[model samples]
Target chain A: MNSSNSGNVGIVIVSHSPKIAEGAADMVRQMVGSAVPLAWTGGDIDGGLGTNVAGILEAIETAWSPAGVAVLVDLGGAETNSEMAVEMLPEDRRARVVVCNAPVVEGAVIAATESSGGSPLAAVKRSAEEFYA
Target chain B: MHDAHASRSGETPVPLTASAVLVNKVGLHARPSVKLTQCAKGFSARIELALAADGPWTDAKSPVKVMRVKAPQGATLHFRVTGPDSKAALAAVLALVHDGFGEA
Candidate 1:
Protein backbone atom coordinates (compact mmCIF):
# COMPACT_ATOMS: atom_id res chain seq x y z
CA MET A 1 0.00 0.00 0.00
CA ASN A 2 3.04 2.24 0.09
CA SER A 3 3.29 3.98 -3.27
CA SER A 4 6.06 6.49 -2.81
CA ASN A 5 5.55 7.99 -6.25
CA SER A 6 1.90 9.10 -6.02
CA GLY A 7 -1.25 9.49 -3.90
CA ASN A 8 0.71 11.14 -1.09
CA VAL A 9 -0.63 14.43 0.31
CA GLY A 10 1.46 17.61 0.00
CA ILE A 11 2.52 19.99 2.82
CA VAL A 12 2.87 23.79 3.02
CA ILE A 13 4.81 25.57 5.76
CA VAL A 14 3.91 29.23 6.40
CA SER A 15 5.59 31.48 8.93
CA HIS A 16 6.33 35.15 9.62
CA SER A 17 10.04 34.50 9.39
CA PRO A 18 11.44 32.99 6.22
CA LYS A 19 14.17 31.33 8.20
CA ILE A 20 11.69 29.47 10.41
CA ALA A 21 9.60 28.35 7.43
CA GLU A 22 12.62 27.18 5.46
CA GLY A 23 14.17 25.46 8.47
CA ALA A 24 10.94 23.65 9.31
CA ALA A 25 10.55 22.49 5.71
CA ASP A 26 14.13 21.29 5.69
CA MET A 27 13.54 19.33 8.89
CA VAL A 28 10.42 17.76 7.40
CA ARG A 29 12.29 16.83 4.23
CA GLN A 30 14.94 15.12 6.32
CA MET A 31 12.34 13.08 8.19
CA VAL A 32 9.93 12.23 5.39
CA GLY A 33 12.51 12.10 2.63
CA SER A 34 11.54 12.87 -1.01
CA ALA A 35 8.43 10.72 -1.08
CA VAL A 36 6.16 13.61 -0.13
CA PRO A 37 5.79 17.03 -1.77
CA LEU A 38 6.65 20.00 0.51
CA ALA A 39 6.60 23.78 0.00
CA TRP A 40 7.13 26.84 2.21
CA THR A 41 6.60 30.63 2.21
CA GLY A 42 7.52 33.17 4.83
CA GLY A 43 8.00 36.92 5.19
CA ASP A 44 6.33 39.46 2.89
CA ILE A 45 7.37 40.27 -0.69
CA ASP A 46 9.76 42.83 0.82
CA GLY A 47 11.42 40.08 2.91
CA GLY A 48 10.02 41.43 6.17
CA LEU A 49 8.50 39.24 8.88
CA GLY A 50 4.85 39.00 7.87
CA THR A 51 2.38 36.86 5.98
CA ASN A 52 1.62 37.35 2.28
CA VAL A 53 -1.49 35.96 0.60
CA ALA A 54 0.16 35.68 -2.78
CA GLY A 55 3.16 33.91 -1.35
CA ILE A 56 1.01 31.47 0.55
CA LEU A 57 -1.05 30.82 -2.56
CA GLU A 58 2.06 30.23 -4.61
CA ALA A 59 3.38 27.76 -2.04
CA ILE A 60 0.10 25.82 -2.00
CA GLU A 61 0.04 25.70 -5.77
CA THR A 62 3.67 24.63 -6.00
CA ALA A 63 3.17 21.78 -3.54
CA TRP A 64 -0.24 20.74 -4.81
CA SER A 65 -0.88 17.01 -5.02
CA PRO A 66 -3.93 15.06 -6.11
CA ALA A 67 -4.17 13.54 -2.67
CA GLY A 68 -4.36 17.04 -1.12
CA VAL A 69 -2.34 19.68 0.77
CA ALA A 70 -2.08 20.55 4.48
CA VAL A 71 -1.01 24.09 5.38
CA LEU A 72 0.70 24.74 8.75
CA VAL A 73 1.09 28.30 9.91
CA ASP A 74 3.23 29.90 12.61
CA LEU A 75 0.73 32.37 14.05
CA GLY A 76 -2.67 33.98 13.75
CA GLY A 77 -1.95 36.19 10.73
CA ALA A 78 -0.28 33.41 8.88
CA GLU A 79 -3.27 31.20 9.50
CA THR A 80 -5.63 33.89 8.26
CA ASN A 81 -3.57 34.45 5.15
CA SER A 82 -3.33 30.74 4.55
CA GLU A 83 -7.11 30.53 4.79
CA MET A 84 -7.39 33.39 2.33
CA ALA A 85 -5.04 31.61 -0.02
CA VAL A 86 -7.16 28.49 0.16
CA GLU A 87 -10.26 30.54 -0.52
CA MET A 88 -8.62 32.01 -3.59
CA LEU A 89 -8.35 28.60 -5.16
CA PRO A 90 -11.02 27.10 -7.39
CA GLU A 91 -13.84 25.30 -5.63
CA ASP A 92 -12.47 21.88 -6.54
CA ARG A 93 -8.95 22.74 -5.38
CA ARG A 94 -10.17 24.40 -2.21
CA ALA A 95 -11.97 21.23 -1.20
CA ARG A 96 -8.67 19.35 -1.29
CA VAL A 97 -6.78 21.85 0.85
CA VAL A 98 -6.95 22.28 4.62
CA VAL A 99 -5.48 24.90 6.97
CA CYS A 100 -4.10 23.14 10.02
CA ASN A 101 -3.62 24.63 13.51
CA ALA A 102 -0.32 23.18 14.57
CA PRO A 103 3.18 24.12 15.62
CA VAL A 104 5.20 25.08 12.56
CA VAL A 105 8.21 22.83 13.03
CA GLU A 106 6.90 19.77 14.87
CA GLY A 107 3.62 19.81 12.97
CA ALA A 108 5.31 19.95 9.59
CA VAL A 109 7.49 16.98 10.37
CA ILE A 110 4.55 15.00 11.75
CA ALA A 111 2.29 15.93 8.84
CA ALA A 112 4.91 15.16 6.23
CA THR A 113 5.59 11.74 7.69
CA GLU A 114 1.89 10.90 7.71
CA SER A 115 1.43 12.24 4.19
CA SER A 116 4.29 10.12 2.91
CA GLY A 117 2.24 7.10 3.95
CA GLY A 118 -0.49 8.18 1.48
CA SER A 119 -2.85 9.42 4.18
CA PRO A 120 -5.85 11.54 3.20
CA LEU A 121 -5.83 15.30 3.74
CA ALA A 122 -8.12 15.20 6.79
CA ALA A 123 -6.11 12.45 8.45
CA VAL A 124 -2.85 14.27 7.83
CA LYS A 125 -4.26 17.46 9.30
CA ARG A 126 -5.57 15.61 12.33
CA SER A 127 -2.24 13.94 12.93
CA ALA A 128 -0.35 17.19 12.70
CA GLU A 129 -2.74 19.13 14.93
CA GLU A 130 -2.45 16.50 17.60
CA PHE A 131 1.09 17.67 18.25
CA TYR A 132 -0.32 20.67 20.12
CA ALA A 133 -1.84 18.52 22.85
CA MET B 1 10.63 -7.09 29.11
CA HIS B 2 6.98 -8.20 28.92
CA ASP B 3 5.72 -11.40 27.35
CA ALA B 4 3.33 -10.76 24.46
CA HIS B 5 2.27 -14.33 23.89
CA ALA B 6 -0.54 -16.70 24.69
CA SER B 7 -0.44 -20.50 24.86
CA ARG B 8 -3.19 -22.23 22.93
CA SER B 9 -3.82 -25.88 22.15
CA GLY B 10 -3.34 -25.28 18.46
CA GLU B 11 -2.22 -22.16 16.56
CA THR B 12 0.81 -20.66 14.81
CA PRO B 13 2.08 -19.60 18.22
CA VAL B 14 1.77 -16.37 20.18
CA PRO B 15 2.77 -12.85 19.25
CA LEU B 16 6.43 -11.92 18.88
CA THR B 17 7.73 -9.12 21.05
CA ALA B 18 10.90 -7.11 21.74
CA SER B 19 12.11 -4.50 24.23
CA ALA B 20 14.74 -1.80 23.92
CA VAL B 21 16.12 1.17 25.79
CA LEU B 22 15.94 4.73 24.44
CA VAL B 23 19.67 5.16 24.09
CA ASN B 24 19.53 8.11 21.72
CA LYS B 25 20.10 11.43 23.42
CA VAL B 26 16.80 12.86 22.16
CA GLY B 27 14.68 9.82 23.01
CA LEU B 28 11.31 9.41 21.26
CA HIS B 29 11.11 12.87 19.83
CA ALA B 30 10.53 14.02 16.26
CA ARG B 31 13.35 12.26 14.45
CA PRO B 32 13.41 8.92 16.25
CA SER B 33 9.61 8.82 16.45
CA VAL B 34 9.40 9.26 12.68
CA LYS B 35 11.94 6.54 12.07
CA LEU B 36 10.26 4.04 14.40
CA THR B 37 6.79 4.72 13.03
CA GLN B 38 7.99 4.34 9.46
CA CYS B 39 9.63 1.05 10.25
CA ALA B 40 6.49 -0.17 12.00
CA LYS B 41 4.41 0.66 8.90
CA GLY B 42 6.67 -1.39 6.71
CA PHE B 43 5.47 -4.60 8.32
CA SER B 44 2.10 -6.37 8.19
CA ALA B 45 1.74 -7.15 11.90
CA ARG B 46 -0.28 -5.07 14.33
CA ILE B 47 2.45 -3.45 16.38
CA GLU B 48 2.17 -1.52 19.64
CA LEU B 49 4.86 0.24 21.66
CA ALA B 50 4.59 0.69 25.41
CA LEU B 51 6.44 3.37 27.31
CA ALA B 52 7.35 1.14 30.19
CA ALA B 53 7.85 -2.58 30.80
CA ASP B 54 4.16 -2.89 31.83
CA GLY B 55 1.17 -1.04 30.33
CA PRO B 56 -0.21 1.65 28.06
CA TRP B 57 0.49 0.37 24.54
CA THR B 58 0.25 2.82 21.72
CA ASP B 59 -0.09 2.04 18.06
CA ALA B 60 3.36 1.87 16.55
CA LYS B 61 2.12 2.96 13.12
CA SER B 62 1.10 6.37 14.43
CA PRO B 63 3.76 9.03 14.96
CA VAL B 64 1.39 11.01 17.16
CA LYS B 65 0.92 8.24 19.71
CA VAL B 66 4.58 7.28 19.60
CA MET B 67 5.61 10.81 20.47
CA ARG B 68 2.79 11.15 22.99
CA VAL B 69 4.53 8.67 25.18
CA LYS B 70 7.05 11.46 25.89
CA ALA B 71 9.77 8.96 26.50
CA PRO B 72 13.07 10.52 27.38
CA GLN B 73 16.58 9.15 27.12
CA GLY B 74 17.12 5.94 29.13
CA ALA B 75 13.43 5.09 29.10
CA THR B 76 12.59 1.54 28.13
CA LEU B 77 10.04 0.68 25.46
CA HIS B 78 8.33 -2.59 24.82
CA PHE B 79 7.22 -3.57 21.35
CA ARG B 80 4.44 -6.11 21.04
CA VAL B 81 3.69 -7.52 17.62
CA THR B 82 0.78 -9.64 16.52
CA GLY B 83 -0.23 -11.10 13.16
CA PRO B 84 1.46 -13.23 10.55
CA ASP B 85 4.72 -11.34 10.41
CA SER B 86 5.18 -10.72 14.10
CA LYS B 87 8.69 -12.10 14.23
CA ALA B 88 9.88 -10.00 11.32
CA ALA B 89 8.24 -6.87 12.70
CA LEU B 90 9.84 -7.32 16.13
CA ALA B 91 13.22 -7.91 14.51
CA ALA B 92 12.98 -4.76 12.43
CA VAL B 93 12.06 -2.60 15.42
CA LEU B 94 14.85 -4.01 17.56
CA ALA B 95 17.36 -3.53 14.79
CA LEU B 96 16.53 0.15 14.47
CA VAL B 97 16.46 0.77 18.23
CA HIS B 98 19.67 -1.18 18.75
CA ASP B 99 21.34 0.86 16.07
CA GLY B 100 20.55 3.98 18.15
CA PHE B 101 18.32 5.26 15.32
CA GLY B 102 21.52 6.47 13.63
CA GLU B 103 22.11 8.95 16.44
CA ALA B 104 25.61 9.61 17.75
Candidate 2:
Protein backbone atom coordinates (compact mmCIF):
# COMPACT_ATOMS: atom_id res chain seq x y z
CA MET A 1 0.00 0.00 0.00
CA ASN A 2 1.36 3.41 -0.88
CA SER A 3 1.70 5.79 2.04
CA SER A 4 -0.64 8.24 0.27
CA ASN A 5 -3.38 5.59 0.26
CA SER A 6 -3.25 5.21 3.99
CA GLY A 7 -6.45 6.36 5.72
CA ASN A 8 -8.12 6.87 2.36
CA VAL A 9 -11.47 5.39 1.38
CA GLY A 10 -11.48 1.94 -0.21
CA ILE A 11 -13.34 0.87 -3.39
CA VAL A 12 -14.98 -2.30 -4.69
CA ILE A 13 -16.13 -3.14 -8.20
CA VAL A 14 -18.87 -5.68 -8.81
CA SER A 15 -20.21 -7.08 -12.07
CA HIS A 16 -21.96 -10.12 -13.52
CA SER A 17 -18.87 -10.96 -15.52
CA PRO A 18 -15.66 -11.65 -13.64
CA LYS A 19 -13.63 -10.16 -16.48
CA ILE A 20 -15.52 -6.89 -16.36
CA ALA A 21 -14.98 -6.56 -12.63
CA GLU A 22 -11.29 -7.31 -12.92
CA GLY A 23 -10.89 -5.01 -15.89
CA ALA A 24 -12.47 -2.14 -14.01
CA ALA A 25 -10.16 -2.80 -11.12
CA ASP A 26 -7.25 -2.74 -13.52
CA MET A 27 -8.39 0.64 -14.84
CA VAL A 28 -8.56 1.99 -11.33
CA ARG A 29 -5.08 0.68 -10.63
CA GLN A 30 -3.71 2.30 -13.76
CA MET A 31 -5.37 5.63 -13.06
CA VAL A 32 -4.84 5.96 -9.32
CA GLY A 33 -1.75 3.80 -8.85
CA SER A 34 -2.67 2.11 -5.57
CA ALA A 35 -3.52 5.43 -4.01
CA VAL A 36 -6.61 3.79 -2.53
CA PRO A 37 -7.43 0.26 -1.41
CA LEU A 38 -9.40 -1.59 -4.13
CA ALA A 39 -11.07 -4.97 -4.72
CA TRP A 40 -13.51 -6.62 -7.14
CA THR A 41 -16.02 -9.49 -7.19
CA GLY A 42 -18.06 -11.15 -9.95
CA GLY A 43 -19.51 -14.41 -11.31
CA ASP A 44 -21.60 -16.97 -9.49
CA ILE A 45 -20.69 -19.92 -7.28
CA ASP A 46 -20.50 -22.18 -10.34
CA GLY A 47 -18.48 -19.59 -12.27
CA GLY A 48 -21.43 -18.56 -14.38
CA LEU A 49 -22.57 -15.04 -15.39
CA GLY A 50 -24.18 -13.84 -12.21
CA THR A 51 -23.60 -12.11 -8.92
CA ASN A 52 -23.14 -13.59 -5.47
CA VAL A 53 -23.65 -11.72 -2.24
CA ALA A 54 -20.94 -13.76 -0.56
CA GLY A 55 -18.35 -12.61 -3.06
CA ILE A 56 -19.38 -9.01 -2.60
CA LEU A 57 -19.03 -9.32 1.17
CA GLU A 58 -15.55 -10.74 0.78
CA ALA A 59 -14.57 -7.98 -1.62
CA ILE A 60 -15.80 -5.33 0.76
CA GLU A 61 -13.69 -6.93 3.45
CA THR A 62 -10.65 -7.07 1.19
CA ALA A 63 -11.00 -3.40 0.30
CA TRP A 64 -11.96 -2.34 3.78
CA SER A 65 -10.29 0.78 5.20
CA PRO A 66 -10.72 2.90 8.28
CA ALA A 67 -11.90 5.76 6.11
CA GLY A 68 -14.76 3.71 4.53
CA VAL A 69 -15.58 1.71 1.42
CA ALA A 70 -17.43 2.69 -1.78
CA VAL A 71 -18.92 0.07 -4.10
CA LEU A 72 -19.77 0.40 -7.80
CA VAL A 73 -21.76 -2.34 -9.52
CA ASP A 74 -22.96 -3.21 -13.01
CA LEU A 75 -26.55 -4.25 -13.77
CA GLY A 76 -29.49 -4.60 -11.43
CA GLY A 77 -28.56 -7.95 -9.95
CA ALA A 78 -25.11 -6.74 -9.04
CA GLU A 79 -26.60 -3.77 -7.26
CA THR A 80 -29.14 -5.80 -5.29
CA ASN A 81 -26.53 -8.37 -4.33
CA SER A 82 -24.22 -5.60 -3.21
CA GLU A 83 -26.96 -4.16 -1.05
CA MET A 84 -27.49 -7.57 0.47
CA ALA A 85 -23.79 -7.87 1.05
CA VAL A 86 -23.77 -4.53 2.80
CA GLU A 87 -26.64 -5.70 4.98
CA MET A 88 -24.63 -8.80 5.86
CA LEU A 89 -21.72 -6.83 7.26
CA PRO A 90 -21.43 -6.36 11.01
CA GLU A 91 -23.69 -3.60 12.32
CA ASP A 92 -20.69 -1.32 12.83
CA ARG A 93 -19.34 -1.85 9.33
CA ARG A 94 -22.62 -1.36 7.54
CA ALA A 95 -22.65 2.40 7.72
CA ARG A 96 -19.23 2.77 6.19
CA VAL A 97 -20.09 1.07 2.92
CA VAL A 98 -22.15 2.54 0.07
CA VAL A 99 -23.45 1.23 -3.25
CA CYS A 100 -23.17 4.09 -5.68
CA ASN A 101 -25.81 4.54 -8.39
CA ALA A 102 -23.35 5.39 -11.13
CA PRO A 103 -21.83 3.73 -14.16
CA VAL A 104 -19.66 0.92 -12.86
CA VAL A 105 -16.34 1.46 -14.65
CA GLU A 106 -16.46 5.25 -14.71
CA GLY A 107 -17.78 5.48 -11.19
CA ALA A 108 -15.07 3.21 -9.86
CA VAL A 109 -12.37 5.24 -11.57
CA ILE A 110 -13.73 8.56 -10.37
CA ALA A 111 -14.40 7.24 -6.88
CA ALA A 112 -10.89 5.83 -6.64
CA THR A 113 -9.41 9.15 -7.73
CA GLU A 114 -11.54 11.03 -5.23
CA SER A 115 -10.55 8.63 -2.47
CA SER A 116 -6.89 9.00 -3.35
CA GLY A 117 -7.28 12.68 -2.60
CA GLY A 118 -8.22 11.70 0.97
CA SER A 119 -11.87 12.65 0.53
CA PRO A 120 -14.25 11.23 3.10
CA LEU A 121 -16.68 8.43 2.22
CA ALA A 122 -19.64 10.77 1.61
CA ALA A 123 -17.58 13.07 -0.59
CA VAL A 124 -16.24 10.12 -2.57
CA LYS A 125 -19.76 8.85 -3.07
CA ARG A 126 -20.93 12.29 -4.14
CA SER A 127 -18.11 12.61 -6.64
CA ALA A 128 -18.86 9.23 -8.16
CA GLU A 129 -22.55 10.04 -8.36
CA GLU A 130 -21.74 13.28 -10.13
CA PHE A 131 -21.37 11.27 -13.32
CA TYR A 132 -25.15 11.23 -13.56
CA ALA A 133 -25.49 14.94 -12.94
CA MET B 1 1.79 39.77 -11.52
CA HIS B 2 0.11 40.93 -8.36
CA ASP B 3 -1.78 44.18 -8.93
CA ALA B 4 -2.34 46.05 -5.67
CA HIS B 5 -4.79 48.40 -7.36
CA ALA B 6 -7.04 45.57 -8.54
CA SER B 7 -7.17 44.11 -5.03
CA ARG B 8 -7.94 47.48 -3.53
CA SER B 9 -10.72 48.07 -6.09
CA GLY B 10 -12.30 44.65 -5.22
CA GLU B 11 -12.18 43.55 -8.84
CA THR B 12 -11.33 39.95 -9.71
CA PRO B 13 -8.14 39.48 -11.71
CA VAL B 14 -8.40 38.24 -15.28
CA PRO B 15 -8.11 34.47 -15.67
CA LEU B 16 -4.71 33.09 -16.65
CA THR B 17 -4.66 31.28 -19.99
CA ALA B 18 -2.35 28.87 -21.84
CA SER B 19 -2.44 26.25 -24.58
CA ALA B 20 -0.52 23.02 -25.19
CA VAL B 21 -0.72 20.54 -28.01
CA LEU B 22 -1.30 16.86 -27.23
CA VAL B 23 1.77 15.10 -28.63
CA ASN B 24 1.22 11.69 -27.07
CA LYS B 25 0.39 8.99 -29.62
CA VAL B 26 -2.98 8.24 -28.02
CA GLY B 27 -3.82 11.84 -27.15
CA LEU B 28 -5.93 12.49 -24.05
CA HIS B 29 -6.95 8.91 -23.47
CA ALA B 30 -7.92 7.34 -20.18
CA ARG B 31 -4.49 7.38 -18.57
CA PRO B 32 -3.60 10.86 -19.68
CA SER B 33 -7.03 12.28 -18.78
CA VAL B 34 -6.81 10.72 -15.37
CA LYS B 35 -3.39 12.20 -14.85
CA LEU B 36 -4.65 15.60 -15.96
CA THR B 37 -7.66 15.53 -13.65
CA GLN B 38 -5.60 14.36 -10.70
CA CYS B 39 -3.11 17.12 -11.36
CA ALA B 40 -5.85 19.70 -11.75
CA LYS B 41 -7.51 18.75 -8.47
CA GLY B 42 -4.36 19.58 -6.56
CA PHE B 43 -4.84 23.31 -7.04
CA SER B 44 -7.57 25.49 -5.54
CA ALA B 45 -8.10 27.46 -8.77
CA ARG B 46 -10.98 26.78 -11.12
CA ILE B 47 -9.49 25.26 -14.28
CA GLU B 48 -11.35 24.55 -17.52
CA LEU B 49 -10.14 22.99 -20.80
CA ALA B 50 -11.35 23.14 -24.38
CA LEU B 51 -10.14 22.12 -27.79
CA ALA B 52 -10.67 25.69 -29.01
CA ALA B 53 -10.05 28.97 -27.26
CA ASP B 54 -13.60 30.31 -27.32
CA GLY B 55 -16.19 27.99 -25.77
CA PRO B 56 -17.48 24.55 -24.68
CA TRP B 57 -14.99 24.26 -21.85
CA THR B 58 -15.13 21.48 -19.27
CA ASP B 59 -13.91 21.28 -15.73
CA ALA B 60 -10.33 20.06 -15.62
CA LYS B 61 -10.71 18.45 -12.21
CA SER B 62 -13.53 16.15 -13.24
CA PRO B 63 -12.13 12.92 -14.66
CA VAL B 64 -15.31 11.94 -16.44
CA LYS B 65 -15.74 15.35 -18.00
CA VAL B 66 -12.09 15.66 -18.98
CA MET B 67 -12.04 12.17 -20.51
CA ARG B 68 -15.23 12.91 -22.39
CA VAL B 69 -13.43 15.68 -24.22
CA LYS B 70 -11.86 12.91 -26.34
CA ALA B 71 -9.06 15.07 -27.61
CA PRO B 72 -7.16 13.11 -30.21
CA GLN B 73 -3.47 13.25 -30.93
CA GLY B 74 -2.31 16.68 -32.09
CA ALA B 75 -5.37 18.40 -30.65
CA THR B 76 -4.50 21.59 -28.87
CA LEU B 77 -5.78 21.98 -25.31
CA HIS B 78 -6.72 25.48 -24.19
CA PHE B 79 -6.92 26.29 -20.52
CA ARG B 80 -8.59 29.11 -18.59
CA VAL B 81 -7.74 29.25 -14.91
CA THR B 82 -9.18 31.59 -12.29
CA GLY B 83 -8.96 32.16 -8.53
CA PRO B 84 -6.00 33.11 -6.38
CA ASP B 85 -3.77 30.31 -7.62
CA SER B 86 -4.71 30.65 -11.30
CA LYS B 87 -1.13 31.19 -12.49
CA ALA B 88 0.20 28.05 -10.85
CA ALA B 89 -2.81 26.01 -11.98
CA LEU B 90 -2.42 27.12 -15.59
CA ALA B 91 1.33 26.42 -15.51
CA ALA B 92 0.83 22.95 -14.08
CA VAL B 93 -1.70 22.00 -16.75
CA LEU B 94 0.53 23.38 -19.50
CA ALA B 95 3.49 21.49 -18.12
CA LEU B 96 1.53 18.23 -17.98
CA VAL B 97 0.44 18.57 -21.60
CA HIS B 98 3.93 19.62 -22.75
CA ASP B 99 5.33 16.54 -21.00
CA GLY B 100 2.90 14.43 -23.04
CA PHE B 101 1.46 13.33 -19.72
CA GLY B 102 4.66 11.32 -19.23
CA GLU B 103 3.59 8.96 -22.01
CA ALA B 104 5.88 10.28 -24.72
Number of the predicted model whose lDDT against the real structure is largest:
2
Best by TM-score: 2
Candidate with top DockQ is 1
Q: Write the per-residue lDDT of candidate 1 for residues A19-123, one digit (tens) a residue.
A: 999988888878878788888999998989999999998888778899988999989899999999999999999999998888889888989888877778988
Give the DockQ (C-alpha) for candidate 2: 0.51
Fraction of true contacts kept, per model?
Answer: 0.62, 0.38
How good is model 2 by TM-score? 0.87
Which parts of model 2 have CA positions greater than 4 angstroms off? A1-5, B1-12
Per-residue lDDT tens digits of candidate 2, residues B1-104?
Answer: 36676673422377778899999999998889889988888888889999999959999988778888999999999999888777778888999999999987
**Scoring each candidate complex against the real one, what DockQ results?**
0.58, 0.51
A36 Cα displacement, candidate 1 (Å):
1.1
